[model samples]
Target: MTLKRLILSVIALAVIVFGLIVTGIWGPSGHNPAPEQQVQTTQTPPGMSRGEYVAKMSDCTACHTTEKDKPFAGGLGMPLPIGTLYSTNITPDKETGIGNYSLDDFKRVLREGVRKDGGHLYPAMPYTEYTKLSDNDIAAMYDYFMNSVQPVKQANRPNDIPALLSMRWPLAIWNWMFHEQGAYQTQQDKGAEWNRGAYLVQGSTHCGTCHTPRGVAMQTTANDETETGFLSGADLAGWHAFNISNDNANGLGDWSNDEIVQYLKTGSVAGKAQAAGPMAEAVENSFRFLTDDDLNAIAVYLRSVPAVSEGSTSRYAQGEAVAQDLQLRGLPIETTREEMPGEYLYMANCSTCHDADGSGSPDGYYPSVYHNSVVGSEKSGNLIQVVLHGVKRDTNDGEVFMPAFGQHLSDDQIATLVNFLTDTYGQGNAQVEPQDVAELRATAE
Candidate 1:
């Protein structure tokens, strides 16, 4: 053959090879559980309120709804690394929602992470962890969504992304590398409650979706509580969800089992912490309804897990010992003069309840801002929302609620208090713009 013809042939071959590599056709196919293998749907026998309870425990509404106007209709704008993902309508609206999803279809999506049409769901759905749920649990979730949830008429908007990046097929490869299949394994050595807790947190609840660290590929670097990194917390949409592991400095090692249950139940425990952002929703809709045994199970499971460090990234660390000592050395005033502006505003408005130092007294009362992670986070979205929209933590043991504060705190004051708290403790660098606070304030109304 002529040199020119041979050169053209080589170019064509190179193009084909490059395409294969980019598309990951050369790699082992990712594990996508077969349709039947993934989810098993059976008729709900009588007296099985397990489905309804499971739905509440999963807290599906957090993503599936925007405001309370349309429940499970799914138009919430979920921010992503690439852009924004609009939640799909899960209501049984045949025209616009998942009304047509059969029991098996729902199960497949939940257990296998595939949509009704075989498209892989974005890991944003957390099916990688959900896939650990048993066939019975998937069926329970399906029954709850299909039979119980009120059908809202809402059309899901297409995901806001260019077609190139919106490609769902590539996720098949992602799943293969990171996703695992099968039901949660019962830990024989551990108690039944602990194993049950493991299944709920690691599987249906998919707590790791927010709490676990992500790899460069953006998948959960570690999937199980067995790994120290698992449930250690992750940053989502600029907000850092604090570590849930047993790390003394950053994780929950210091928090007692009762405190964990209390926080999950009531949103805040007296001197400890309060729920904020997506976690508030999880508490309000899900954990508050958990059975005492289940809450205890979760606490026990969390306590039993190993502490894995995802990396050297430190948000909570050894504070300057001398600085904390100096702050403590001073007879703590009710609130300092400069800090009093924010304090006075809070008193006139929030003090009848939250008290002066942002400490909610009377044991398990309003949230304490001192040393609280939500106040300390670099991202002010959750903190801003709490100030602007007030949050009730959760109702696991019983309901403990915080009223909305948006009407009371002006944008400047909110910004001032945020600055004061961050400066005093927390990651001191956090700053909120009046403009951003105003924007969020608009949403509160």
Candidate 2:
């Protein structure tokens, strides 16, 4: 054969091989559970089952349920830069949800990102991370959703992404480029606790879905411990998912293992930081219910994470007490001297709960603004969101609630309040613009 013909033949062969690999038509096959391993009909109800605990670990309700909808009935709108993609109903509604799915069908969706009818699921489901979940966990979850969840007749909301971006065919290519199929492999060198933590964080919990930054095409920059940006931080919706890394300044470097455990279990750590927005939801719905051993394992794994600095002061360094001044009270005498709108706003609206000195209750039930992770962080998104949406945490301890100020406070007022809080209690010069506030409000809505 001619040299050119031979080269052409080799190129064609290579292309065919690449195609097979990408489509999973070749290469090592994925795990296929035996028929007997399928979900049993007489399993525990989802509400009180071990599978319920597994679902909480997955935090399924956070995405699948909307504010007004029944849990797992879906319709939660996930706003993306491209467009809005509503979450699918995972409830066992045969027509609108996964009710008709068999064990293999559910497994395929979770591990391969394919639906019961052979449709591609968007990456928003975090199947990339779910793919790593163990077969047992998958079976348990299947049982819970299928047997326990009440089916709602609500139809799935259609995504508003542009046609070019919404097509499922391209996702096949995207999956090939970004996804890794299979269950999580336990690292031989790591202890059992660390391995378990790694599985929970990387597989079931999918913590990196929010905490890790995204690259082009909006895929998480890191999926596991190997990448530099893993759990470094990411902006989600209107909130900033703070760096959970060990960076002494911008990350959790100064957080003790116990502190991490406390934060996960209770969503607050006295003067350090309190969970808000998505993190708060996770705590309320998922983490708070986890076993002490599981929480400790997570803490150990997180504490071992390498730090990724972003040139900011540590939470330890930033929590110095601010001097109490009458000016912070918006008293007539103090208000007449300076035209600080933010100070007045804070005094009038925030001081009663956060305190005039910006120190929360002495017990840390109301976390002090000073040394607070949200306030101290470089990103002002969470601070802005907390002000607009307010804060609420309910646990075994008690309920902590803050009323939403978005309806009452103007963009200018919020900007003023945020700027004042950051300058006074946190790292100064974290200026927030009125326009920024307006945008955040819209996003939150």
Candidate 3:
């Protein structure tokens, strides 16, 4: 090979690589819909009037509006890698909202992640999930936004990302790699209930947002049961989103379908896992409103899912060993009156505010330990902090805060109270230790 020929070969290889990268054919495509293509209204169903129900299922209002504003007028701002992205106003205001959007235009955006003007929507909208909705669902959603939602005149703020991050063309390429660009297909072999559940979880509700694992690109690795890892639990903002698959280890393989339905309907579905963080939002705003049929369908679908074998073992699996070690370490297994200084400690410090039942104010002021799920999780870190360093609950109508108790309660007392709460209300997981309290306090500090 001559030196000139080698140089030409290198140049050709570089050009080929660049071409593949630019064209987005180097990897699986992401969900990227052109704005104009997405907003086309010609595909709307002949007649659909149940738009309100569809809108509720979609939970558009939760992300689209801030607490103080009109629903879907678009003021919620979500954090992104580069910068924050504000929600867009979806009201039918001709000037600042979707008033100009025809049914086809609305359909295009929701169905394809494209706007009427031919711009691509950011993935933050969960279009990757929404694209799986049936065309009927898309039409119903369009009607709901158009006719049912109240219109407010509001302008969408420009994205906070720099030009490099905000560039839509690159996202178009990214979408080409990852986005699934069609409505969900009902499995021919599945029952109607299972299909309904699958559609709900995979499409409008996007259960995978919390359950699915993510790749380096920050998108859910895969959206359905065909992927063994789907719903196999992944770490979220700060906490772990528990696996929802039928895996016997970390997932819900042990939970009965009824328990799942009950948990979804109410915040408390004892002995099983409870909702918290963003999941709390999902429960309060969305799941709580689902029809009994829908809830059952969800349960049925989840139960029918084939279980996956998880290589990552759960800490609870080694409970017997952990318990023996705790005893060896002189961690008290039984709470004598002397060891349980928390009883007196609670009377002196917390009785006035929290009450003897461990139930705080019922008006949703202070969290009630009698019913609070946080005190009941396997991990007591959050509960220890709540007792040691009190927290202020975010109230809608007023300002109220839980005072910090670290100044008053010793590590032992904090541990005892947490243990009491866990034994009383929490599931029968392992007991917490004073060392655990100290570690949690230090971390919070």
Candidate 4:
């Protein structure tokens, strides 16, 4: 044989080997589930309502529903580094949705990130954490999707990613590197309540997907409470998911277990905190509907999460009322409004609802900015986001509405107002500039 022929053969072999290593073409995938789980999938759960409850526990509506009229006909645009990925239609429509997916197929999709057609779904579905759901829960969820949900006929949209990047094969490599597929294993040392809470937070809720920091690959840096980074708080996409762990100042360390329960149940805890953004949505759709036992369990588990202090400042301890009202009162006799724009903005726009002292109204319907987690946090992103976007959270009680000033106020004006809030009622650490407001405003847009 010629030397050139042998050299070409070796080159081809090297390329093939490289491809195999990178893509893990030979590796096992979403088809695998434990023997017991497989058997449990076949059996009927005690009640159909449990299925709906499980669906809510998974917070399926948050990602899968965009329009109010069309729930679970998923078309939410999830932003990726290279491109945008649109969620698939999960409604039970035969033509465009998962109408034909069998129980086993649903199980594979939920736990393994494999679609019914044997294609890989991006980790945006949170299958890595969904893998921890019990077999009964998976079965119940399947039942809910199949029988309870009203099927919508919307066609699935193609992702905006590039052709080569869109190939499913590369995901095999990603899965091998990042995915941890399995069901929850109960801790013998912990009580039933703690275990239940752990299962809910780590499994269905997938709290780490937001609260935990991510690696370069966008996989959560930590999967469970055993890791210090798990739920340690992450600031991303212009919003900060504050630490839900037991760290003081930054986290819930100073919060009583009952306070945690109240926060989850109502989306507000008077002077302490109030939910806004995605968290407000979570409260409106999922957490507020949780059963008392489950709420208590979650509180118990969060209380037990080891303290992970990020800084010396106790966020809740910072700031006092700076008498902005007095400044506003003397405004006519003193310098022009241009001199104190921050104070002026607060008094004119905010004081009616939030009060001159930044203290909430009598009924606690409007929450205080002072001694509040959102305003006092080190990052100040949430406060900025709230000011730009406004707050609208609804529960069985009623709706809490704060109108958006994004259109009315300029970037500099928004920054001025937020800096005033932080200085007068919060830590005064957030010396927000107009650029900060502009950047975060762009993301929201």
Winning candidate number (lDDT):
4
Cα distance off (Å), candidate 4, residue 200:
0.2
Q: How far in Å is the alpha carbon of 350 misplaced in model 1?
A: 5.0
Model 4: per-residue Cα lDDT over 1-445, one tens digit each: 3446534644564566568777877444344455453212222224537788778878889889999899999999988865789998899999999999999899888888889999998998989888888888888788889998899999988899867567776565567657877787777688878888888888877778888988766789888788767898887678988887788766888888888888888888976888899899888988887787787788888877777788877766666656677766745724636888888888778888888888778898987778788877777888888888899999879988999888889989988888878777777767888999899988983
lDDT of 1 by residue, 91-201 (tens): 988888888898878877886788887888887887777777666776767887788788888777988876656777667756655677656666657667777778778
Off by over 4 Å in 3: 1-49, 306-445
Q: Would you list the rank order by TM-score, best first?
A: 4, 2, 1, 3
Question: How would you encode candidate 3's per-residue C-alpha lDDT over 83-148 as one tens digit per residue?
Answer: 778889988888889988987787668766788888888888888888776666677777777777
lDDT of 1 at 435: 81
lDDT (0 to 1) per candidate: 0.68, 0.78, 0.65, 0.80
RMSD of each: 8.0, 6.8, 9.3, 6.2
Query: Which residue pairs clash in candidate 4?
Result: none
Ten-residue segment with the worst summed lDDT in candidate 1? Answer: 317-326
- Output the lDDT of residue 277, model 2: 87
* TM-score pick, better of 1 and 3: 1
Per-residue error (Å), model 4, residue 347: 0.3
